[model samples]
Target: MSLNGPRGSAWAMTERTARDVDRAKHHFSVGPSAMRWDGETLVIDIAEVSSPLPYKVRGTIRVRPEMIGSTAFSLDPEGRHRWHPVAPRAHVEVSMTDPGLRWSGAGYFDSNFGDEALEDGFNDWHWSRAHLRNDVAVLYEGKRRDGTPFDLALRLDRMGNWHDIEQPAPVRLPRSAWMIERLTRADRGFIPRVAKTWVDAPFYARSKLSTRLFGENVEAVHESLSLNRFRSTIVQGMLPFRMPRAIWR
Candidate 1:
């Protein structure tokens, strides 16, 4: 899914998959999305989407590693789940050909892998990424299923320095239309406000917001996920409407 509310545009598409999925190493292709590491960079390609909204959307974004290191941390105490920001602050070049979608600028890339489904390991979580002048800061805070809470604060600088920073205070933002509470960590006196509601659903939401962090006022990508709500029958029933998928050849 992608959104540009400032330009009055948004899109979402999903492709169904079989029960058994290929577990290839560092490479996979399914439906409209595919990725493979080419030694120097991670290449991602997306084909034209035709669901949720009919539009020809496609692009290839390469995430090249920089001198600054990445972040790899475990989410659970048992090490069942882990997250990695391979290229926290990478130069993104976009060549997407679409009617109302074309952009090329700085972007972020990350991945998550776990031993079990998220619903079985987590209840809710708030994630935010702030791109600064010479560094990129990210925050991860959430509650584990076993009632354990974890908060991580990390910053990667351009000179290959990775350090742990103090956790900024939680800046509360207004709830979404779905009544999902939104909050993010920011520096002192750094007010954060949602600039756009890219995607808001019963159990998930993604937004772009502004905040002061790393001594700069930066726009951050924020997301909130509620595994408890996602496991509900009502949300599952409504999922087809937003993520309807057909067999892909």
Candidate 2:
């Protein structure tokens, strides 16, 4: 989930990336499927997969009744997860309801956060979320590439657990399928990508480092992630040779 507008409001833009596409159709996408109480706090499960990347990512975010203490999240698929107070509030900037999770507002660390800070945050941000429903309203507003205000919202759908498994295509793999693609939309447009998370991602480590580290030790935890550069790629505007991989899985 991503932050959209001011606090109490949110906007979410779910996308398909090159990683998910296949002969069936490039398809990597993310969405909230189910949310329920694991007692007092809310537990949300999320899955993601990228073709170019070897790992398929999936995990859950747990929220406590207090909305602060015991509120944590973990990504088991990528051999990564952070449970401590990553954000300043010692919790995430989230509020959930019936339809989906809205990343409308961030943490108190960002209460005073503006554009530059927000931009940096996005680049470095892993994820953020807010809960919402029909009774509850959420509005996400931001600047588009043209610098125009970009906004979206999740009013009321039917929050919690999607109708079925949040898979890209109907096809299945050993654990799950993973794919990636590079496309040109037009003469002058951004390339399209497809990735599937929650559906499948590979985990190579035998030891669950994050779970053990977070559940036990700490250096200095984080509440919300400060964006730096989420992802970067080098393309050939002009080049004689191309980089190639020697093997394929």
Candidate 3:
């Protein structure tokens, strides 16, 4: 399933496997999130998942070495249903040591999390108003040197009392940042000596939104989404929270 969607109104469990992180060691590795609405204040929950059991192949147990989680968001009545998922309510925690890495943040997701979740096909974009809506997210758009668009979605829910903030998300560094050095194009089979990555989610009017970046290993693409040009960037920003430095190496 894709990690992004636009909730006009809107909307996770796995077991012990090899691909799964060690429950005793790095079990808190989760995210690539999503967003939706619960009632008013927008409830978003992200999990640090770890299951090194391997899930894609048919070798009894196979899972990809990627992080997992989801985002929960509502819609902005002022924006007239311009669903958009932004920062979490607060900054989640991500850390990296010499042997372990963990990411503790919030987003939107249901079940089965891994790297395969960001592939070309085999994804489900969803939303919620009365019931869960299976949506077709417009992804694969950004300018990360190559063409690695980060597949994500968003939604603005009824602000209720705290209607001042459009997408109330708490931007946090990925746990990966704790262990890995400066991100380089080589991180994405491209360049080298990345310098560093910078982020700032400039939220303009509950509807207009965009993310900019400078460095390497990142990709951007602007694709089609219900007659809208949804642009995005893909970077290594999900480790500083749930992963330890040990696991990062």
Pick the lDDT winner. Answer: 1
Q: Which ten residues in a row have the lowest lDDT in candidate 3?
A: 200-209
lDDT of 1 by residue, 1-249 (tens): 464545445465675575423446888776657788877877877675645566666767677766435456899988889998877877766555553455667777878998999999998899998877878888889888888888888888886567899999888888889988787988788788898888888998889897888678889999988888998999887777766655433
Give the range of the ten consecutive residues with the poorest summed lDDT in model 2: 203-212
> Distance (Å) between predicted and true CA of 167, model 1?
0.4
Task: Name model 3 segments beyond 4 Å from true.
Answer: 1-87, 95-249
Using lDDT, rank the candidates from best to worst: 1, 2, 3
- Candidate 2 off by > 4 Å: 1-39, 65-117, 120-218, 222-249
Q: Which stretches of candidate 1 lie over 4 Å from their true place?
A: 3-26, 53-55, 67-71, 98-100, 159-161, 245-249
Please list the Cα RMSD from the true structure of every candidate, rounded to 1 decimal place: 2.9, 20.7, 17.6
Distance (Å) between predicted and true CA of 200, model 2? 23
Instruction: Compare candidates 1 and 3 on TM-score and give the better one.
Output: 1
